[model samples]
Target: AHVITHYHRTIDKVTERFLGKRQIGTTGRGIGPTYADKINRVGIRIQDIFDENILRQKVEAALDQKNHLLVKVFNRRAIDADEVVESLLSFADRLRPMVADTGLEIHRALERGETVLFEAGQATMLDVDHGTYPFVTSSSATAGGAATGSGIGPGKLERIIGIVKAYTTRVGAGPFPTELFDESGEFLRANGFEFGTTTGRPRRCGWYDAPIARYTARVNGVTDFVLTKLDVLTGLSTIPVCVAYEVDGVRVDEVPVNQSDFHHAKPVYEEFPGWTEDITGARTFEDLPKNARDYVLAVEAMSGARISAIGVGPGRDAIVVRHDLLGAS
Candidate 1:
């Protein structure tokens, strides 16, 4: 499996709430601008760092331009090109030992009939081009990004597994139609321990919106859905799932393109009975409490994807693997 992470947004922009006017509390890893620069062709690639002179050239050009903007326009301190170059060089040296042509590598592995895995970081709804715009992330976070980022071609892709919380959540600035700031929202957050793994910021929590999941499943060609955090709903007497949205007088099954439409879209919830007690330690599907199993089946019906695996807790062992997602045991 190749685990790759995209660059984060700039420190200054994240705090300013650039798009949402909400304090996103982004990790400020410069992921946004880095991807922006990449798309703009001004960004540095890992391969480019191999040539020392080329590295220096790119760093100097970027720093010279950025420092000017920082001092003149933003009134921030200037960054030294030498320091940036040095840091990049250090990182490159570490990468130099580990880097390989993934194209050749994966091809060789497949030729040998070995199993390979491509794990992704972000969700489809957070994708820059396909997701909710302006509030979206920097890179192609969807399954399509796996091919480009991994240096692979289209036909080799056998399956794409999409992971989703049993309910829903979003981290940064965007129009979240199902977001709840109320006590029920608190219930989901508190019970699910809804927090960002990378940013550690509190995730915007809501119910499972089947329409949203179906949209993502379609766009990404998701073969299956790994419903995570299902155990969090075990103790509730009543659990709500968002099946559709009703805006104005119109009932909508798909997500609205406009932010205003989305913001105004009220979730039409389908309530289910919640089970009391914990099912986290249960390893087998047969061992799962009846209510828990019913919940999974119900979610599968609503989400429009087969629930392949269920995540009960944060530990690696906490996952209950039902069907083989990658077509390998």
Candidate 2:
């Protein structure tokens, strides 16, 4: 039994009421609010559900402030404390069986020399501390966040793998240096099926950015990269990859230190020859076309990490594994 921390409905309503018009393209699932409560030292944990009185007390305390904001600021109806308590209480019996000290469990497993795989939710550019401010997610999405969120030390984790798209795509409001406004963007969107899994929002597509990949690799200590959707770039005569950025008058080779500089940054692209051959069925690295292989190698050379795997198509078996990710060999 592993107790995974999850979002609460009360937190969701609070977030909704707080960010009335200035929504940062959230899934409206209260993930941000729940994390905020955890940080604010007022969150109700899964274990709290078992204790009805304490759960009710916490819910009432939270709503006392939330109701004020909803009623006065947002003009929305205040959520009832009794309703929230009842909702949480109903899930206690079912959730108690699953709740355990997951952090301790993980520590014990590692003590027995067992391997633990930690799969993170979001990308590096969406990280709160490192990413673009005011436009980033509330939680830490970087490698450091893995330790904090999972109650593990950073030294315990090894082999950080970054999943990068052959081209770039971002949703919601943010500064994209190489955002495409023409048919190239549309082509990538349609071909790559660039749609948000939860929000159903169409992603803003752009050319591949080597600088961003390099910067993420540096920040997250990425050992390998898994490049996806290379097949979508096929059939085009030429593909442009952003090698650097021109911020104001200077050519910046790395991510700008300031958000304002990044917002005004312009991409400096280097053209690569595109391939026409279908790569969806290619299983081996050598099976790819000369140009495709060249493109992969070129991108690898520019990016900080080695590309161990490449996704040619959208299918589960469409990946071409170049190297052993676990280093068992």
Candidate 3:
């Protein structure tokens, strides 16, 4: 939600209108608008959901501010607080039993040695503070955010599994170092189906960037990498990976702090042979195409983290494993 409506407020109104359409590839989820409210501290949670009196006051306060912004800046229609409150109150029957201490529940489960899989939204490159500034998502989407977002202590976080694309991609606006603007970009986008899962916007595609991956691994304390979308690279004559960047005639090993330097940085490419045919059903390391294996090895060397599992396609069993850091039962 925070990833989608970080800037605009009309997302809810617009998205809600397209509830049944398959045009946007979305189901009119209210996630983005709700997250926006959470950041503004005007969100009515499940707890506030119970008490209508408190919920009424809360909705009125939020609507007051929202309507002001809508009328003054966007030149939009004003929202009625009473109407909004009444609509929200209508959901009280379904939301009652679902409201509980989720953090406490997690703690109890952990005490019993039950494994908890904490799934995160978006990728590290989309994270607000760590990723490309101003163009990034409003919240932390990296592995580190799992602790706070899930209401678990940092100590409970035993490992951070970083999911990376075989090639790099980004949505909206940002400084993408290896973004391919030519036929290669289009090919990757088409083959990989490189589009935002949330917004359905076409992703900016590029070769695998080792420097950015290294930075992400270090910053997120990633124990392992689960490289996805590898099968998209099949049947290519050659493949290129960005091993380093040349900024102002000087080569850098890591991502630079200066935005200007990053903007001006030229990718120093390392080329490899592209594999023909598919290896999506491969279950073991040796089952991969020879060139595909080389690509993973090249990435592992530069990423500064072990390659645990490689996702060839978007299937539950599509990933081939070298090792599983989260462990296999």
Candidate 4:
């Protein structure tokens, strides 16, 4: 694993500040810079901590260039290499005991008929290679990444379960075609509690984006989707779903090929009648209100894959499972 040095955070902050309005709206927790260090072949790794001399040398080498950029280019204070090494070394003893050949362990478990789940931290739209360029995360956030990151063959993977919001929400700066700027947006924000878990920043809310959902299904080979927060739209008179995009007078059913076109694309919505009933207690597909079922079916038709599960509310038991994710669909 690539280690996050103190300088990485400092670098990320300084660079984002330098960008000003052009900032990528990252968490500023040293993620991008740490990946940069990994690619630059000067990164401090988990193994480096066990060897203090190697850790110090790597940190000093990275800071040698980074400190120059900080002092001369950004007019910022130089980060001390000693402090960085010290901070990282402090966690070595605890982390070592837990580290193992995870790939081998997973492989053995599979051989013994034990199931292993690979969960991604970020969404498909945040993948570095597949998502919106220059506005995406530092790493892969797709099903394929699970295999590569875990040191498993792609063939070892069985099914891909995609978790999608009934309505879309994005944390950082990016092109959102169906983004709501009115009271409906506020309603979703308030009802869904659309706030970043760590930053507590308000997420940009939108309706169900079918085109993006289809794109994700194609890219990630999603077998099933868990449609969450259907209860949020319960009180609305109508719900608008983005079925396609109007890009320069042309209707595009998929995400636009060009970034500029995507940035300017306008959503073409298909409306669904809303329901008034509270669905938090409903545990089965049949228990849902007629209108809510229609909305789900409409979205399911537009979305590329089957919505195997529906989240009616925030509670753990609020989900309605139409299909078994671990079993054949």
Error of 2 at 217 (Å): 0.3
For residues 86-128, write the lDDT of model 1, one tens digit per residue.
6666767678877877789998998898877888787787787
What TM-score would candidate 1 get against the native?
0.89
By TM-score, the better pick of 1 and 2 is 2
Query: Which scores greater on TM-score, model 1 or model 4?
Result: 4
Ranking by lDDT: 4, 2, 3, 1
Candidate 2 C-alpha lDDT tens digits along 184-245: 99999999999998788999999999999999999999998999999999999999999999
Q: What TM-score, to 2 decimals, does candidate 4 have?
A: 0.99
CA-lDDT, candidates in order: 0.76, 0.85, 0.79, 0.92
State which candidate has the highest TM-score.
4
- Winner on TM-score between 2 and 4 is 4
Error of 2 at 278 (Å): 0.4
**Model 3 residue 133 distance off true place after TM-score fit, in angstroms:** 1.3
**Candidate 4 C-alpha lDDT tens digits along 45-70:** 89999999998998899989999999
List runs of model 4 lying over 4 Å from the truth: none
Better of 2 and 4 by lDDT: 4
Pairs that clash in candidate 1: 7-31, 8-30, 8-31, 8-32, 9-30, 9-31, 9-32
